[model samples]
Target: MSHLSNHDLPRLKKNLAGRQEHNSLKRYIERTREREYIAAKLSTHSPIEVDTSYRVAVRKTLINPRDGLSMKRIIGESDLLPVSYMQAGMKASKSVCRIEIRDSVGRVLGHGTGFLIAPCLLLTNHHILECEEAAQFSLAQFSYEVDLNLMPLQIKSFRFVPEHLFITDAKLDFTVVALENDSAEGTTLSEFGFLPLYPESGKALLGESISIIQHPSGAPKVVAVREKKIIDVYDDFINYTSGILPGASGSPVFNDEWVTIALHHTGVPDPDDSSKYIVNEGVRISSIMKYLNRLKPTLLEEQQVLLDSIFAGSELANYDRNPMVIGNLDMEWYERSAGYDAIFLGENYAVPLPTLRPDLRRDVAKLTNGKTVLDYTHFSIVMSKSRRLAYYTAVNIDGGHLVSVPRARKWYYDSRLNRKYQCGPELYNNNDIDRGHLVRRRDPVWGSLAKKANEDTFHFTNCSPQHKNFNQMIWLDLENYILSNTETYNLKVTVFTGPVFREDDVLYRGVKIPAEFWKIAIMVKRDGNLSVTAYLQTQKNLIRDLDFAFGSYKTYQVAVSNIEILTGLDFGDLRNYDPFRTITAVTGDIEPAIVNVINIPSDIRI
Candidate 1:
């Protein structure tokens, strides 16, 4: 090495006298636009436009020059604590665990980390045990931390009890699990103290140090000190600056006081350089706690007591325990089967809501504009919030004199159901798909309520995504044939129509286009027969590589019992009255009757 001369020393002193600086608006705008562009791409919305105000915000003190960080407005600057204090506190708590997700052969397919939140409960990322097979056979090893001399210690392994109470949400990305009170080695779970969840919502602040105790790559557990800084905090997640490896997933991120702040989940690579990770991500602990509190009532008494103890001395402990249903829809009448008065069975019976599957989140609310329940007459509809489609529509059909109401081309967005909540004209714009009415326009037209019921069927909530050919040809043909069947005589017919919402549905233009539709028609025949027939139609062939062009759709007559199994809705006694039930029993082979396209009306079993 060569010694520095007098010239070199003077130059270095002059260079160190001032700090590095740059003032380029173009550079600033370019960086800001790049970040916003990435955010818009990640989101479902359209690309964001960087306006003048956004540029000013960028030029102002929005980003720190030293570390290129922007603090959350809600988080106070005083929330950060010293690194030494945080590490000591977390070491004393000793709550983190090593998780191994195994396959059927007892071999580990993946590895993750976890932490105890309650006496017999562990909180981790949902991806660790997303599937039933992995969740059922996963192993959780506690006390895997390094000893005083930095050597491996005796670890206690615990098997997961997924069947008991495994609550997980894909959007939130969390899995709350209840561990056995005793481990495989017969060690009490209470021996390992759990890191208490930070009760307050904004407990973790941006730019503050975060501590993590994890088993990186499923190696022996070790403590990582304040090497991470929280970058941003949202309603459900906390983005941070840290280098978390694959096995570090589900690791507990703690504050200075050892209060669990977040559960580590993901990482973001540097945009300019993909090889280096820029930030890590975690599911906020506060959101997880709220979900756990909501699911507390369904837990065992022992689990409840454990949760109570962990949540003690916090405001969340005394929070309301009421489980509120969405949209305040009364499910009592909807859940009941053949929900109608027995006395009015022959006259003018109104069909009630079908028993919607509880697993599907259907936020059914009364559509109210300027009318009461009476104005709706013999028709009722329930809408699914997530699917943006009708769960089902129930209508009473009078086969006496079919009302000659002209088809109203006037399609209005049902203001009764919030405009944002319904699948409006945006989905059908420039497409061959029609707003197919579940309660056919003329189905509910009867008696003195003919005019009002006909108008109510025009509501958007009663509509579903249907191809023009499927709706006009097969669907309408089936409806007209059933009503004109001579067996109807003067009897009233009730029909329940709905879309089959499968998880793997084709998503198009922010809407999930259903592949199949189901309709169950019930009526008292002329021969005093209480006949029930269920029909299914598929529009999968109509959609070729997302090009939803008009094409032929096949309609099949399936058993009413099969509808309950496929839709997970309880049809109750309706299955007993199916005309195909006897035919299926006689043959000792359960199969759906395919409708013949050539002879549509005669093929239907009455």
Candidate 2:
């Protein structure tokens, strides 16, 4: 087939014939005038002059004598003087403006800078407003230099990007502020002047040249054009060889065409090496633009609402003012009852508190082996400072004596073998499961008047029903682990133990029985480290009714491993109790029995 058909050629020729000729003379005049304007502006002094002290400091700190002499020599020898041209360009673009923060005092805090964005929106780091309790900011008129002399410049107002609407990806270290009220007074843009946004998809390639315009260290606007290679692009930030300095954060970076592609943010300055220059890093503009486009609608709506409210007198007139009240509860309350005090102090203290007493408190404490009351119930009452809060069982002289057996049914039920065994006894089977104690109630010290004063610790609110085998094996192991570690770790071990009530009315032989099987949950703390372990009995009877309770064993094991890694303490030995027994009871129920012997070393520190 022919590349160009006869019909296509005629159409192409007809289209070419309709093309209009350009006015070469007018175009040439326009191009010449643009060049003249750029050159004249470059030759002129900056509209905002640099402070003399800053100039002197820069010369003393940044300018190397050898390099300065060499640059002078190079300027004399070379036909191209780009540095001089850049200096001239910097001077022409500089414009001084005043920044003011409206505070609760109804007065303004003033700062100076060479600001370029119009309608006079001040660009600043987000952290600047972090401490301010105000809702708005304002700007005032300042001065600009013209013809080498300072002239008054009017500033209508200031606008800030919405704090809530803006999105920031710290990985990129970039933020975008969309202009809201562009109608601010004295705001103007040159016909050819506009901040450029990055094109989507492609990035500035390696070895690309870039320029930055910023008010470094609150100095006048300085345009630094440098040719630098892109060294790295991380998830959220880009690193380049372009020079940047302190106080340049939020400054714009543009390409040779004056198109802004990035916002200057941070740099590493090397004071040890005089010849070393700071490397600049910035947030890519394309990322910023994407976020801004998403936020534009919301920001516009919010700004309109704010404006309407301001004009309609609906806005809070003294919204910028700070409140004047702060107080704390009396320490006496905490000293009297640590448990009650902790609940109040933790969070949302204003809300009504839940009563420490639960229904289980009355039932479980009444079912104890002996007629004596549990210690934590008394502790709870003492902490609450309320006699009504304490629950006690009627003293029964006929109740069985508190038997402290070395190996209990709880130990066998808590064993790994019992947990692995799927077939188990029924939960309420009298012959299979046995009730076990975590904090043994009959132990002399635990039952003593002083120890029992902290009733909250002994209350049945902390107990759970578990299988006899699981409690004896796994539960005993956990308790032993805490006791073993406490010798040198100074750990405080608080345990809550009880049996699950199968029925409120199950009769054992002739007597009414509460439940079978026991459970134990222990909270241990040493120095500042805290850990919690829970054990459920896996007796043949109990497992049949509640297999799901031990389903979290895998997760618990993982947590235990993590604790071991962090604390460098071994708790695995605690799980080494014999599992063949039916009922293993804790033996020694005296004051200085197993409890007192397991005292943690007081010298252990965090």
Candidate 3:
């Protein structure tokens, strides 16, 4: 706490005490019956609240309504709310994140709190992120807190793209900066929904309880709830009691309904003694909204739309961040072929879907049939509940029976499983992320159920976030060669595909993006013996300056044992049938077989 005085607080207080906006707030708080004051107060109330005999908003203000209108929904009127009220606070907290102020050299300068006011935009203190250059160097980190198990959850960091859009008000102390649309790890910024800045007042009143979601003193996220009371709301600021005071600036102050009413800036210092502190003050949300409206013309049309959307889209603010794709799908439209026939290659061969480790069982989403495998057409998917994606997908590919279904490319949520456990379009929107299918859509489109299988492949559970135009293209090309080469002999092959989940995979839009993807192909060869091979999509070669390099995505034919180790799953007897394993045994070692997978597994007569 003492370190903050030298770093953040002293400067923050100096800005507040020295600025004209700060004194103007105090003057507004002092005067009650001025025309400007009345007009400002009226802006907080709607003309629509049924101005009955008991409560006439404008009329009473005309008849001295300051105290009357402010008390409409005040504590005594109706303080009790449903349990969902607490849940809303939890939802609202998603938008709030810890801001690590860093320099050009990546040195962390200080920490503050900030929240999204729009999908791409973040709101923090001008003192914290003073300018576009400052914003560009700083990073916004989310999920920097403990999980249900009390273990520290993975923290995801996103760089600011303030050059895209940056607006700051020094006097009132707020900065709205844009973030990169997608995180380095494929998560979209839109997943943490924004807190809309309301222009009108009456969201909270003097004496009403308020809460502040913040990163106190640069620690993990915490909420200072209830007991803290709002003392007064002025023209541009709200002064409030400071129990569990917001040590970190830029914290969002919320009303009972979880609506953001102000941006916490600094404490009101005691004049007689600098060591003593009085109530804390926050710049009002309405004031910031008004400031934005004044500067709205300066923004580009699309930026204006993003700004305008915050107000128009407040209804969606209460949902868990990025409830992007959600709807009921008629199970009847689905293709119900028995998923991934293990013996599809015939009586002599078997490739049962890979088995998950005992520890991973809890993270697997079970279907209505009480099975971990979600059977659809020629494929079966085992989805991860935590990652909201497929742990692995096994599909029986009938190379000869492959049907050409026109690609309409629409994705859906699997209603048989809970929506909360599924990643949706929200993860892919506004980014170069491709909704990659674990089971290649064409591979499972076979026989009478071909079209339905194509449609079934569109389910979100079958999708994994992939780098668009880069690894995805190369990976798809390599897969096509394997399927086409298999058609030359067996006319049948079974494939198992999945992500290689790493503890440090990039977190994008509430989901961790897998760095590498893998696939294993099994089929009967022309020699009447079974064959197995593995391939992996790695970003190591395609990485340029810490970002993906387009056209450089490399696919390598690797040992089946490599795939098994990468993914925490066991492929039964498949290893004995692996050409790479045989090669490894004879040579005492093996390397990734090929840069491009055209070096077909020796089992296939390419």
Candidate 4:
């Protein structure tokens, strides 16, 4: 045989490259046809959302595990009708894409394939985005496929939403990151028909024929189907014979119905021949979901909504948070007609309201009147419209009715109140002020009414801006300690809280920052006598010298009567039951004792 001369080397290499490209294009076309066939068959029998036949097949596979079948057998036996399958493939193709991962300075570091699990979320391999650094500089290229004319490629690129969520798990080798809601081209990710993550596992089978839509070797998008089969299934991993190359790391593995089953990760190499591969492996979608469920409750409202879509069949579907409307829950009511007054048993079966609401400000501030009275399951509030803050929030907690629900920090603007008059996220964002819930989240959470009350506290009308240090430390401890030892109050306690809106309060960003806040906790004692203790916490140090950063706050147990005088809001008959009433001086003001970390619980006069 004659070896090629130097002159022929260039031609030979060019011919080989052209051949490889041709083979890739051929494989992509063939798989695209298969994907469409499956989708079309699916559309004929059921609505897209509820594919009963697909579910039944998955269920059957799980009930009786089977060995892998030959590619010929799998394809020859496919029952997908061509027309419907073509429609389905066309629908699903929009979701699968070739992703180019770039580093800082816009240089492409690597490439992979990712699919949308939610409108704003893309699921990929952890190895593709290992850390915040990787996420900070990466770009997600979607629709990187040949145009209808089959000459030029069509693609949309999106940067990661820097201020959004980027969660990764190396142990599971999966990363779920949020894409910018819209690309620079103004195309929303939702318009792409993003694939929803299958919450449950009855959707994929042991011997199912799977297809991988991927950007193999960082090349243009391709669908690898002909040789794919789920050879083995482990608890955390699945082995398949899908055709993939180096850059197919995060490609989605889907069943005939276009439902995602697993995330393609790595391929096994043939030990005898290093150049060839044996079987490819992927992280099980079910396993990825288990990890996602652990994070749902803790995510922000928008994030929870995204996660809820993935695991919609589970409890997350009814997630009541709406990002557009600040603090709006789907349930229709400020009061659920569930009668929260019933919990205020004994002498006062009714929640105490402020006798006199905060006087309208006579200052240079704009008066957009948001002062709206709203009622929740376990609490009520009289929000000060002019000040854009709550005048007072009254809450009745049946200490005996405790629900160990973790606090859901889902803040919102009360819909009943005008958004302009409400101090919203703008005031709290990038500032030292914490959006303090005047009606503590856990206060109203009891029995069946817990969820509503927990949700109620998120409204901006029921929230006030307090120093972060003050809200999280002694202030929070006081609430928690009181609830923990509820037996002291016969398992029932009522709290009245609000900011001390003095005219001279520090002004920050057009909103008056209250320097002080007060809380009065009332309960029926063992003797059936009403007992009330008042406490005041101040973040005066934050703005005293124009040093408006968060600093330590002082807590003092004062007379309830003093709180009434200082805030100009009456605390009802609770003033007469104050434990510190006798401690008042000749000036009619009870001197406050310094409450420190050492005696936060004991220092309280209660």
What is the clash tally of candidate 4? Answer: 9
Local distance difference test, per candidate? 0.59, 0.32, 0.68, 0.62
**Tell me, what's the RMSD of every candidate?**
24.1, 31.0, 18.6, 19.7
Candidate rank order under lDDT: 3, 4, 1, 2
Q: Candidate 2 vs candidate 3: which has greater TM-score?
A: 3
Tell me the number of clashing residue pairs for each predicted model. Answer: 0, 49, 3, 9
Provide the TM-score for each candidate, comma-separated.
0.40, 0.29, 0.45, 0.44
* Winning model by TM-score: 3
lDDT of 1 by residue, 69-159 (tens): 2232212234444445545465444667888766655766667788777545677766665544456667889877676798778889888
Q: Which stretches of candidate 2 lie over 4 Å from their true place?
A: 1-103, 106-124, 128-135, 138-194, 199-203, 227-230, 269-278, 294-606
Q: Is 1 or 2 the stronger prediction by lDDT?
A: 1
Candidate 3, 501-564: lDDT as tens digits? 8887777677888878888877776687677877877653442322545555556777776676
Best by lDDT: 3
Off by over 4 Å in 4: 1-331, 335-343, 348-351, 357-372, 406-410, 483-490, 545-547, 585-598
Model 2 lowest lDDT segment of ten: 394-403
RMSD of 3: 18.6
Model 1 residue 495 CA deviation in Å: 0.8
Report the error of model 3 at residue 251, Å. 1.0
